[model samples]
Target: MIEPETVIICLRAAMLGAGAVCFGAGSAALLLAPPQVASVLRAYLQPVLRGAAGVLAVAALVSLAVQTADASEDWSQAISPSALFMFATTTHAGRTSSARALLAVVSALCILLARGNRIALLRLGSLTAGLFLASFAFSGHAAMHDEPTRTLQEANHIAHVLSGTFWTGALVALFCAAIILLRRPSGDQVEGAELMLRRFSPAGVTAVVIVGLTGALNTWLILGRAPLDRGSIYQLLLAAKIAAVAVMLGLALANRFYFLPRATRPAALVASIAIECALGALVIALVAVFGTLEPV
Candidate 1:
């Protein structure tokens, strides 16, 4: 049987990953897409954003309870008001998780109440989603350090997560747009989609670069050495995560260089991007596992 802690970690990762997809996709649409294209994307994305944020809020609360129980090593304490209060009030992870839950709630409400207001979605929704992601920095491995190192680790973690989410989430948006365009073929829509892809290429490249750099820095900071120990579960998971990322990079390169140039073959483009999204999901799962493990 899987441990409750592991289950909660997976739950947190899934919710946070889905939330990132909304955030990155929305932000990319606002920044990279033409007004008409963005409007259409928004029509598809807003519902997802609301749903993911709502789920994230609920998952955060549920995870908080599970974490409290795990921390207290007494399953009954999961529902004990005093234990819950102490955990939420006293622990770094508890405070951060609480903040994340609040941010997720606010994000959901902003999208729900905005009700087609682009400005509010862009401002309030993005602000809350960004904060939700940033909350992870205050918990987990990043928060375990002292003094200036803690600040440095936290900032690096934020950059790492933001860039990673942007990369994976934008791929999700691109895949959705590709599928829709393929279904309802249009010259203008194709042109807009192509333009969006063009705009995303450079940004995606930059985000991936940051993810690599900051990820390496984070690993070094956490393990205090290179991650080469195959004997340890944490190291093995880390290696698997790295391999998945490398495969993603290869797929991205193929999309950028091979499939993208042949714009007429959008089926091929769609296939490649879909694969990237799948791999991105895999990476999130791997991170969820390794993130909960102690490095060797």
Candidate 2:
């Protein structure tokens, strides 16, 4: 049985991962789609983005509180305003938590302010979301390294996360667009979905490449030449994540090369995308488990 602390860590990681996917992917989809399509997608996505940012902010605070409670061995101390404030202001974990909270707040504000045909507002919101996603690197394994190595690892981690989320999240948005197109069959919506898919193909390929490269870098950094022994839960989970990602990549390639050309069949395309999204969720769940295990 997993310890309560491990469960809490997994929950925290899952919330953070979900928030990253929603905000980062929404931003990417908004930027990648054509203006008219973007406007429509934005209407569908803005509420989700705002809600994700709010949840992230609350999750960051709760994570800090949980850690405080664990360290102090007193629930009251954890909830004490003075303790929370001091921790947020003083400690490294607290600082990262505060930064995540601040970023989420800023992202939410940007989302709220972003309305209508203002390209600048959209761009601002997108940039803020990216920044919010980047904040995760500071609090993860990348932060454990030293000096130049730490900077490099963090950069790679940021790239890995942003690219992964962008692909998965954009796929989700596209899936929704496909569903809308199927139900309503509007000419503009159909055209927009096709155009978005075409544009996304190249970007998706690029993002996958980056995710693969950075994932390798992260594994190397974490394992330091250690073999993937079955005794090590982290290594075992890492292997599982890699295998899941491999399958996801295979599905993506199949969708882009085969099913995509037959774009007339909306049902088939949506099914393929839906499967990919499920696999992506599995990868995220594995990552949450990874967060709970210490790397050797």
Query: Who wins the lDDT comparison?
Result: 1
CA error at residue 185 for candidate 2, angstroms = 2.9
Stretches off by above 4 angstroms in model 1 are 117-119
| lDDT (Cα, tens digit) per residue for candidate 2, span 111-226 | 66766666566567556667777777887677889988999988988998888777776777777666665665567877886777777778888989999999898888877854
TM-score for each model: 0.93, 0.89
| Residue 208 lDDT, candidate 1, scale 0-100 | 94
Local distance difference test values of all predictions, in order? 0.79, 0.73
Misplaced by over 4 Å in model 2 are 1-4, 112-122
Q: Which ten residues in a row have the lowest lDDT in candidate 1?
A: 114-123
lDDT of 2: 0.73
Q: Which pairs in model 1 have colliding backbones?
A: none
- Candidate 2 has what TM-score? 0.89
RMSD of each: 1.9, 2.6
